[model samples]
Target: MKITTIETFVLGERQLLVRIGTDVGLAGWGDATLEHRPGTVAAAIREMSGHLIGTDPLPVTRHWQRLARGGFYRGGPVLGSAVAGLDIALWDLRGRFYGAPIHELLGGPCRDRVRLYTHALSARPEHTGEPDRARALVAAGYTLVKAAISGPVGFLDSPRQTARFVRDLEALREAVGDEADFGIDLHGRVSPHHARRLADAVAHTGPAFLEEPLRPEHSRLIGQLTATTSIPIATGERLYSREEFLPVLQAGIAIAQPDLAHAGGITEVFRIATLAESFDVQVAPHCPLGPVALAACVQVDLAVPNFYAQEHVIDLRSADSRDLRLLTGPEVLVPVAGHLDRPTGPGLGIEIDEDAVRAAHRDDLLVPRGTPRWSHPDGGFAEW
Candidate 1:
């Protein structure tokens, strides 16, 4: 069947959903939530729809090539996220057509279940309460948890800032005790010097990984930091394509964390995982968006043999059950004992609640959110 219409619905507040409807009743949903730039992703989808509408959806690989390199200028977050969502929907379409899960379409399951980790964010340095959150996550059956160290780290971190991070790590380690693994997300908010020192400082904690210690632009420095620290360096959430990831893999980085929503969807990310495997690096799909994004990541996680733990943001323990509510019917997707059962249902395996999505949807807020800006105490601009 051919795609009859390509519609983008701004689901919830920050997530954008791309629905590719065929002349038949079946329609596949994908997420293009660009967090800070959701509107641009939607615009790219609108423009890209010209090529997708009224076309056969069977040859997804050809469709991917047409959507990606078919454009004169290719490979930015806006286009990548837009293409990512569309590519995922196309995969889902094929899977549903065959009455199989996407993983089976890829190459069948590598594992019976995919392990997951919950992300907890904190803007304070001394917030020792992260341990309590970790404990709660553990209680919810997560054996792995990630917490953010979201402080304004400058070129050089003072002893006070370093000590605060130490306290946070110490508390996290103490709370999780040997029962779970802990990862620290630098969020690319730290400088090169601070990243190295922080990695070394928390070495005793045995963090699962230090995520994006420096921005993707500082990838060379990331290799340097990886060499200096014993901890695994996980990145690639910002790296949009395989060529950009080549250097990091060559640098002997331990984990490849490409986002399904930003890294050209399952098609490219599977290729990336295969490339990383040769370097003895494991894949951990980055996903902190809505349900569709998480489901897409889960498909890859189960298909790749070298896959690591998946990142999940929908905390059943959190105040908002937005993830659960975003889907329709009984939720078959739930992590148990820190592992998600391989989805047996066809396609992406989760159904979108169109009514709830419509109810929560609003017109694009048409406000310009340029880039994130931050300043240090001394009045110089800092990377955020």
Candidate 2:
């Protein structure tokens, strides 16, 4: 069937959802969330929708290439994420037409379940309640947990800062014991010199990995930092494409964390995983967004052989189940002991609550937000 209309709904604080309506009275949904740039991504979707209306929605790959490479200025967060929203929805449409999950179309399931991990502590580096939070996460049946090092670390902070960073990680490790894995997220706020020091200091804790030690621009230096520490280096929530991820993989990063939303959705992320597989690197998709993106990630995670783990903001099966909000058949995403079983439903395997989505969209219209700004102690601009 032909695509009849394309729509985008900005829900909550930072979610941008896209809905593709077809002539057959079926609608497919996907998340185009770009975090702080919801307006920008929504505009990009509006612009890209011109290429999709009245086109065959089942030719997902053909549409992916045209939308992704159709522009002269190839790839970036905006375009990749925009294409990701449409591409995922196209896959959803194709799956529904065929009565199979996206993974089944991708070549069937590689594993029976997809493992997941969640963040324990706040991004701010503080030891207070750190261990208790770790214990709670482990008690919830999550075998893997992650936390950021600190917020906006100075170029060269004092020894006390390093000590506190180490202490927070140590506390998490101790709380989880040897059975579970603790990951440290550098959040691209730490410099190479300090990243090395932090990695070395926390190496004894046997972290699951050190994520985004340096910003995307400093990818060349990642190998240098990896050489200095034994902790596995994982990055790529910001990289966006396989071309961008090539050098980082060659640099010997043990894990590659490509966000399905930012890395061109299922089509490109599958390619990224295959590329990483050639280099013997694992794929742990970076997903802190909404349920649609999380569902998209699980579809890829199940079909890829090198899949490591999935990152999410909330556990849908737990007491805090905001993930289940505004959706029907969210059971496809509910975690059983930190693992998601293969979804047997067609399409993205979950349906959207259009009324709830519209309500959230109306609320968002009442209060729009601009990009956030932050500053270091010296008053210099800081990364947020």
Candidate 3:
């Protein structure tokens, strides 16, 4: 069947939904939500659709090639995210057409369930505010949790700031004890020197991994950081293509954190994961977006043999969880005991609530990303 139409829906400040309609009564949905750049990604998707409309939806791989490399000027967050949205929607449509799940189309299931790690932001700076939140999630059947290291961090951080990050992680570890595995997200905020020092400070805590220890551009520095610390160094939520990831993979980092939305969707990330696998590294797709994006990541998680854990926004555990549930229609696969059972489907198992999607657009509920931009005491710009 050929793609007859491509549509985009902006649900207030929530999700940027992309829907692909086929001539044969099959429709697939995906979220193209790029933090702080939804409109731009949407426009990119519209531009890409010039090629997508009237094309066979079955060749997910070929479509990815055309959308990603077909453009003379290509490959950045905007185009990557745009191509990612269509790739997922096309996979969804292809799966429905085949009456199988997207993972089955890629390969078969490698594991019965995909394990997950949720966000653990602390209420207080020095402590993991409600340290019990980790316990509650563990009680709900999660075995792993991850949170950003708390306290303000600049190009260089002070002794007290470093200590506070340790304290915050310590609080979570102490609160959950051995009941769950904890991870530290450096979030590319610290200098390489500080990252190495922080790694030493928390080496005693047994964090499962230190995420984005340095920014994506610091591949060589990351190698140095990896050498200095025993903790597993994870990065690459920003690197878009296989070429960008080669150096870091060679650096011998343990985990690759490619975002489903930002890193070229299921098609490219599957390739990225396969590359990581050859290096004996594990894949933990970065997904803090909505259901369609998470669903796409889940499919890859099941198909890849080296998938370690899935990262989810803690909001999935919040009052907004209902809204997420609504957006997903009946394709919602909530994590059980911190593990999501392999999603079986015709395509990535997301069915768009077209009405809700349109209502959100009409209501203009597109959630603006309000991520903070930090600053030093003397007014030097700080990392967000």
Could you say which candidate leads in TM-score?
A: 2
**Is candidate 1 or 2 superior in TM-score?**
2
- Better candidate by lDDT, 1 or 3: 1
Better of 2 and 3 by lDDT: 2
Q: Write the per-residue lDDT of candidate 3 for residues 213-287, one digit (tens) a residue.
A: 887667777888888889898888888888888899998899999887877788899999999999999999998
Scored against the true structure, residue 209 in model 2 reaches a CA lDDT of: 92
| 1 against 2, candidate with superior lDDT | 2
Report the lDDT of model 1 for residue 108: 97
Candidate 2 wrong stretches, greater than 4 Å: 123-125, 318-320, 363-372
Model 1 CA deviation exceeding 4 Å by range: 123-129, 317-320, 368-373
Sorting all predicted structures by TM-score, with the top scorer first, yields: 2, 1, 3
Sum up the clashes in candidate 2: 0
Give one digit per residue, the lDDT tens place, for model 1 in 1-384.
889988887754457888888998788888887876767788899999988999989799999999999989999788999999999999989888999999999999999998889875554544523777788788878888998776567687788878888888888888888878888888888888888888888899899999888888888777778889999998888998989899999987888999889888889999999999999999998888878899999999989989989998865433246567877643466666778888888889877777787676657543445556878888888776
Local distance difference test scores for all models: 0.84, 0.86, 0.80
- Highest lDDT: give the candidate number: 2
Error of 3 at 250 (Å): 0.5
Question: Candidate 1 — what's its lDDT?
Answer: 0.84
lDDT of 2 by residue, 196-253 (tens): 8888888998998999999999999999987888999999999999899999999999
The worst-scoring run of ten residues by lDDT in candidate 1 lies at 120-129
